[model samples]
Target: MSSRDTMLARIRTALANGPAPQPPQPDWAAPVHLPLPDAELAVTFAASFRRIGGEFFYCETLAQLGAELRAWLAERLPDDQQFYVWEPTLQALLAEAGVPFQATEAEFKAQAAIGLTSCEALVARTGSIVVAPATASGRRLSIYPDQHVVLARPSQVVAEIGDALRAVQSRYGTELPSMMSLTTGPSRTADIEKTLVLGAHGPRRLTLFLLEDDA
Candidate 1:
């Protein structure tokens, strides 16, 4: 037989065997989720967050947060690094706290050493911080800067990823943001020679300000 006919006969034999068996479908109804805890979600979150090389600081009140923020800035700045805050609420808080931040957009674009922003919700199970375009920070404040400081309240802490999504729904209803991101920790990669490197893609240092309920 000709090579062409031989190939065609092989294809017909394969087709006569019927279609291939399909792989099993994943269970999409309800995926495995961590149980909501009766213990303090903040504590659970802090532990999980810190385990991945993130810095966690619990502040009892707004005043304490302001003071600690000031102290942190004082220690970190003065090295000719530019600090800026853009979000309206964050700007107001920084102003009220007497914390210095560059408001000029040009300077921020030129060299933004540190960026301060707030988050939507803090995930306790995976130590993930949920963020969306709903906030004034948008995406740049959390991604572009080398150092990111997240100022979050106790009420924003949730037990799981699903809980965070539910909180977002309750806050925004059907008009949800275009995107949602769960930041478990500072950006890191072990792709090169299996040598771990932090800040390879984004912020090298991630500091969280977990404010108390009253704050």
Candidate 2:
């Protein structure tokens, strides 16, 4: 045989003399898990999230969430700049906190500075915020804004991505949303010149507000 043909024949001979059976993948049906309290999960999630350049706030109650959120906005956003929110509960909270926001689609493109949304879960392992179509107010609110703030309850905190998936499944039954996004920190890209760039396709800042009391 020629050199190429000899090489091919050798490869075929090796394959024919290979191991009898292939190794099986680990069983995912029984995933490794331990029951964790929300307090512990919150601490782990906060550290993981902060490591990725995300801002985190823990509130003991919804009233605390409102006050802290209002203060946070006042410190960062100017009076003239627009803040947008679509979730009805969040809207009510903002109003009660005396925080100004535009809910309707009035000059959204020109005025969307910060967008606040509710989340599906807070994943502790990856410090990720899970946002699904069913949980979000609108797709644009999460992706189009300069700053994105996610409001989550302590009950929604999960230890891992799989846990988050299971929670979503339980929440929605068989009819799942079209997409579920795991947002870890801000949107970033290193494609252009191998230099890290933040907010390449989405919000520059990702802030998480975890309400520890009363979902």
Over 61-148, each residue of candidate 1 has an lDDT whose tens digit, in order, gives 7788889988998877657777777788878877887778876566666688788888889998989999887777778888888888
Please give the RMSD to the true structure for each candidate, in Å.
6.8, 5.4
Worst-scoring 10-residue span by lDDT in model 1: 30-39
- Candidate 1 residue pairs that clash: none
In candidate 2, which residue pairs clash?
A: none
Q: lDDT score of model 2?
A: 0.86
Q: Cα deviation in Å at residue 46, candidate 2?
A: 0.8
Q: How many backbone clashes does candidate 2 have?
A: 0
Per-model lDDT: 0.85, 0.86
Would you estimate the TM-scores of all the predictions? 0.81, 0.81
